[model samples]
Target: MTSTPQERLRLVGREEATPAAMSWVMSLDDSDSPRDIIDALGLAPFVSGEHPHALSAELERVKPDAALCPEDARILRTSDDESTKTVLAAGEGWMLRVLRRTNGTAMLHVSAVTEELARTVIEVCSKDATVAEEADDTQVSMGFWHSGAHGFSRRERTIGAATWPEIEQNYSGDISAALGRLMALRAEDVSGRLLLLHGPPGTGKTSALRALAREWAQWCQVDCVLDPEVLFSNPGYLMEVAIGVDTYDDSKRKWRLLVLEDCDELIRGSAKESTGQGLSRLLNLTDGMLGQGRDVLVAITTNENLSRLHPAVVRPGRCLAQLEVGRLSPAEATAWLDRELGDRPKPAVEAGGMTLAELIEARDHPTRIQAAPADTTAVGSYL
Candidate 1:
């Protein structure tokens, strides 16, 4: 009688459980043979329902390590026969041929091999990545998990207020800091914090916020909340973000960052001076009772100066820190212009020089690009 993988684990017992060694255990669904179990998972139509052969064809096409049984509602585990095939004699026994990895750890997969194991198989397989064994219910989800592991989708292009290049160039360093903050929060079992980016227009604040989302997508899930009015109008969006229902994916279980663009538009100046329910709603979203136990990073973009913003909105301990993005200096401006003009006689720019936006605007006209320093007495048109 051939012993099964589960029996083998029992035979190997304490020895195989060594800290230095680990093995893989894959579960395959068997409840529905010849039936594409992919449909039950609610996968996109492009991969399952839309195709003629559906999941079976796709699974066979991909040739995953193990597959669901076509006739019996069971899973079949396989490995190379070159190595020793272990036989563990136990109740409901089976056989397993170990697969050796470079790390020298023996890998084995076992399934319940019964009609009842269908749901478990799909669950084990449906997991996009290693699912957490256990997490606190009261804890706010980590931002790194949200942006990188949960929120991002390879199939869908991210829609943001800024262009891809604009986002990358702007958030290179700032994104790193934001992600670091998120990781720290996760390490300390704390929730995400809001990042307030306030300054004059064209300073790359908005672009940085978007880039932070994309960069953080490598580890944390990030979602951009455009137009607070639309989000709060539905009430569901507000509820979702408030209740931790607005998550990157099912595995993550909660949101990491609630990117609120142009929050100033929603909460700017004195509350008495503003004209919408959006502002108060945003305030409630950030500090309200529902916000507790949730990790939320609110990246706000505003043209208004920080000093002038309403005390309630910009107060310390509320926003954490106010990042100021002033206009680019002359050196930064020249570098930016050089990139845009590509050999059109680089302009002499200094710190507090023409902003990138201004350089682009000015570079469009050849005369302005070659214009003498305004202080140079302009070589007089008389010459």
Candidate 2:
């Protein structure tokens, strides 16, 4: 049994204290065992916050023979560099590893094991560097920041207020009209659970997500699931985000929207055959029955073809909306270009079937970008 001896006991401003308080303070006790001290103090055993299983609350294991609250778990990790070759060069404690989706890896220093500390460890390991520039606490946190230990971050993000209008101007006609109808939804009218936004690169997927954040700011807290790949593989990491045990600014918001950006394989065909249980977990989250009672909406963006998506994952009722952020039409592209060169013999340069992103780059360059870089295999592409 652990013990800390007390030679003397004193209380300041004891004038108003009760007789029992005075009696407790007056006892100059010797060392007491941890159990005796806990019993005397009437403190409950510490619990770990990383809820095992889906939402099970049972205390499965204890760390270090006792639990330490978050405030008590000292900060021992500083360097984010995950490479073992770098050598952290710091003292060791009960450390946990979290692999974030977008942000750098996270190292959690646990002084003692308890639920709060485990949750804190996941959070600390998952937290992205806070917004560098001054933006509102909510808006400033708008983007991906992964924790290496957690695989992906359950990081919250909502784009700044001023940027959405400017981003809207980038799209005209069909794309613009399609988005307008959805944005016009009344507070009580929203019925869908999953939003599938599929498109290729340079089609303004990131910007579109930002706009959605702005559109739903009044009712929803936008949370980014930074690492979709790891999200399926790691149950502990996935549960924290799925359960959303800890949410930001929940007082004002009625719902939370989770973003699984650039997740091609999670929704693609053969997902169950190849990707394992992650795809199933994702589909379950969007299910009408399975997703009941949870105030959350999932928005996923991918670069895969619309036809190739998994049939079960994209069933009619499961998805609230399926909007494609595809290449801009010729007329739309011309209109965008016309914004810069209004009515002065606009340079005609074969702009058919080009993405807005490609057009923007072409306008800036003296010549076109090199032929798609020879289609060489790069790291991190889904098969």
Candidate 3:
């Protein structure tokens, strides 16, 4: 009778067999099959999984209690400042390998004699690692979605952003009032499913969105779609983002705010002719059959004027709020400059008044503003 790989592995003990297994794994290239490597190394019946956005501190806490194979450790210098580390360790009946990258992505592979041990270790590590990532009130947790070779994937990060109260004065009185009401909205207060902000670039549309994320951080999970065109055009990708699994606690279902920025072409008057099914898919995500019963809100920012946008997009009752984020008035600009540049000489405001970005640039470099040509556009004019 022939002895199986697992029976042979148990006879030698995992700790004794680890050095040889690590040597074999290190010899394999990225194109090699992982299962083949495991079988060749007598590590069958093993479980493997990956954890995205894994915290370094939590990984350090969950490292297997085993002897390290320093000789087989690999360090990949991804860039001048970033490096990826892969380490292998083994105990009496188990072998653990960890690959951690500088960007907070990590993968763990464990080979144990029993399936229960392998699953329990993975579950405990994932749960404990995520718990440590909960953000405090000062920071907002945001999810970013992108389409990769594997498909649409989401990664989360905690970012520090100014609260609505801190940046309320950055906008004109009318714009501020409109945004104040939008920011104060609770889940039950939501009437429509769309939030539209149309304006020229550099008027603080992106900044306002960030502040809105912080204000609604308690009841909403804000997710920014990196490629809105692909999201709307590809039905599969759209479905992945629209029907995302809610990973929050079951006690309360959290609403999702999907932010699509600089989507001028997708919602313009001729969008249907130019973008095909893109505009229709976006409408469906907001309030059409696709949006029924789903607690999802779509917020879009475009540089086009409200009149230039497609009628279907800005139709009444479809949007919760649609506000034009225009530049500040001459008087409002003067007040903002006075507050920002306390002792410095102020720059002359443009005839059409200055956008918030222009105000910031002027406050930071008053001399540059005075020397630049009158036709020169502001730094974020095309944002």
Candidate 4:
């Protein structure tokens, strides 16, 4: 007395089925096979796509009214303190999911019976999410890169700093002149692909680079590599940073400047011995075969002196500009302090001139105890 497959399927859910479920069951025809009925109930043959962008308040504007899916939310969260959130919503024949993180990043997934519906949902959610804008002239959009569990990832941040003109007085006169030339460079003026800034710490090297990024924001994309040692040691990681698609515009790519800070060990005269192929790979990325056809520039900051760096790195024609970001001269330091202190009595300038950091410290706390400078000869001891 075994019933047909259709009868078995209908009977399985009969007792517990809601009115809507029962109505759907009754709509099944005799011509429909068990597999066809199951497929129809599960919404098969749907189109799906995903888009990622910076999380913004505009997500509230997504159409079809996305709602929270409590069951699926925070499943990927490692701890209760985590800030990742997930929401989902479904309409007549479409479903959308949004996963937003605390770091201002989000991923959107949409599924629908038609391709057009999926695309429309994505467009609505991503319209204003991907735009990178600064709040003011003092801030510039910069990308920060790091290798994570998910792989290499970059997050765009609006970094705030003084303009080159505002901070030009911070560096030595010679260094300021060289940097002025470098900052004023047009795309055609790029003779070499590497930019090297070598000096002891507290000389305003990092500050200068920040200003440089703001100046070139119009034509060059600046990305600071957080883990440069890993970048050079891992070929895959280097390639990912070097040739990865520019998210800004794919049609006409902009120049990129990759900043590696405190890379003393990676580019020293004995780098080949200490870092192995790390130095070679870095050289290749700057001007060798790896650099050909790519509008990429490598800008490195280190406490190592220029003479102590690898010959290949500082050789003529390799670096677009090799500037020594040293402390200002005694006269320059005295003038800076006088200008900064104004009517207040200025602190005595060090006989050997003063680094920007020292000058700032002096201006803020003229009487604080000063420790001896860290040993710069040791790699990674000073930034």
Candidate 5:
């Protein structure tokens, strides 16, 4: 029987891929010959121009039938003004692939087929550069993961997020002020590793997050975790997202805010009792030692009640800020609606029970949404 790729270990001279070795691993090229680009990148140490090298030997043993194995490699040519082309080898299951563009921005991709090995492999590789110095060039960044891997597709300066006043123009309660203080909270403000934003949907959790991201653009980089459920379950996945591989280790430790929204399953009161991946892993990520001194800050948005959150998560010194995002009052909603939707004759639009998202939707389609009936039923009110 043929062994699977996951069973193999990608060893480098009796050791796994190290940061320095990874830099060398990525420098390997196969554009001209199998691992041909290695010469172009001047990989004098990693490979030889010889026909059969250690790398090909590794591949050959793993995939005897070349037709059946899917080759994994990429060549990125980045030319803003000056152009450059870089190539790296790839194959399914424990392969070394380098994502390098013409502009010299490089990201290393190293994954083992199994979770444990993948974790160990990535742990070694990222101890040096997953995102690397790329963080310096990215002011505002956005990323998402699929099947446990992700990339920063774009960078932004402002993202055009609204300012405090613009976001809270309809605020009739103290949430806007609370948001002010929450966003203003700095590293010195608290010892907690997490921030909790709980409320109904459409209560401006997203807007407030944006405002905070923009407000703290100087030192904070907001990263919205697209898949919170798989984050803790996949060791290799979480390592990259939680402890970015390309992170800088300067005196001024860089910070990335991992924002998980609508994570009701991960922060519920029953989380502490469970041993499974859902809430338990999240608690570990937040309260466990791995999160203790890490420069990353966790932000979770959920419609679940704050009181229902596991005590371990919301306990003293664990959360930097816990803000309840509620909808605007009737009076505030009236004024806000007037601002959002041009002033018109008064309509009995019951805004008290409505969320900000609902109000905005109504405002946008005023013709469709009729005035509130004299007697309407209570909303389940997730927002």
Candidate 6:
């Protein structure tokens, strides 16, 4: 049966697609043209002999009925009898292309896509929306004497490798001390220490933060910032959603364990004066604002020396107790292996002086790893 625009859209929103439907649809704004879309999506130039057209032609040859439809306002379908059809529709200064397959699998493919994809398509297909929703979401954060920056949505919950027991086993003494401080945060008698974990690249700083996040998530909201660049593009918007910081109209549930990973990027000490502004604002949010009530727990990870951070960040009242997170100690290394390989230390016996992050990368997941039961309401919770 031929699919209408609504049917096609419904397929795009679904979780399954037929093999023939395993295709990509790209919609570009006025800021995006055919050439720009090609570059953005990493497609080869149409002019090159070994280019995009070659692939499309190959698709056509395999299915004689396959064809390309001309660009138009309404959804266009190709007249060719090929197994697949490339339909192009342009409107309100934007372009939309859908590759429709004859087989049942098209529905399956569209169904498996992410919400970001669905949202992007909807926005692009709507009248005159210019923002492209497919921009890279992986955020990188760095700070001087602080944790790194990370980009994350307020609504999404991220899973990580470490857990409470893992953190306790590795950094027992430090974790114990942190726990005391964290518990004290409830009283408002003592200010909480912003755990400033610093170490070498590939060190367990980020891993430790993830572990810390999982550990404290059960008790308080954990709002982590994994990217710093977002601050540069939209400082006001960034602050509105930044960890431990709330706006005039924020809800009570925003209290969190604010984890800022790789904060050194913002205050690396070599950049321009403007960089300090974000760091200053971040510090204020962590301590100055949240410090009064002690309702927030701030964890910042960095590779830079704490002594080098700007005064706005490292002052005594701001982040007094800085903890150094390095490669796992000898005891930590052995214990970690014991946890992963229960009775047998097969990999650990052979491996030497590797961080948990390194070991995780070296081994395949769902092997030494067992999947934890999915959290039902985890998406909206503090974790």
Q: Between the candidate structures 3 and 6, which one is better when assessed by lDDT? A: 3
Write one digit per residue (lDDT tens) for candidate 2, span 200-273: 88887777777777777677667776677877787766666666644476575467678888888888997888
Worst 10 residues of 2 by lDDT: 53-62
* lDDT tens digits by residue: candidate 4, 1-383: 86564663342223222222232242454665443433333222231122211122223222233333323323222112266555554554455556566665665655665667666666765764543442698888788889975467677777887788898998888889988888888777888999999998999989988998998988888899999999999998998888945555565678899999999999998998999899999999988888888899999999997779889898888989898999889999999998898888777777899999989987787576769976788866756
Q: Please, what are the lDDT tens digits per residue for candidate 6 over residues 5-48?
A: 44322111111233322344445444433433423233211222
Which tens-of-lDDT digit does each residue in 1-383 have in candidate 5? 76554454232321234433322233222223332343333232333221112221011111111221123333322222233232343333344444344332443434444555434444443442322223342234444444411332322222446666567664446877777777676756646778898988777788778777777776767777777776767776676566653435575455778889888877887764553666656666777866655677889999999889878778887788888888777777777777766865545667455578877777766566457645435576343
Instruction: Provide the TM-score for each candidate, comma-separated.
Output: 0.45, 0.58, 0.70, 0.71, 0.59, 0.45
| Steric overlap count per candidate | 25, 24, 0, 0, 10, 45
Question: What C-alpha lDDT does candidate 4 achieve relative to the native structure?
Answer: 0.73
Which numbered prediction scores highest in TM-score against the true structure?
4
- Which of candidates 2 and 5 reaches a greater lDDT? 5
Candidate 5: residue 168 lDDT (0-100): 61
Cα TM-score of candidate 1? 0.45
lDDT, each prediction: 0.44, 0.56, 0.73, 0.73, 0.57, 0.46
Candidate 3, 159-182: lDDT as tens digits: 787899998899999999999999
Candidate 3 colliding pairs: none
Worst 10 residues of 1 by lDDT: 52-61
* Residue 31 local lDDT, model 1: 35
Model 2 ranges with Cα > 4 A deviation: 1-140, 143-147, 150-164, 245-250, 288-290, 343-351, 366-383
Candidate 4 local Cα displacement, residue 152, angstroms? 1.1
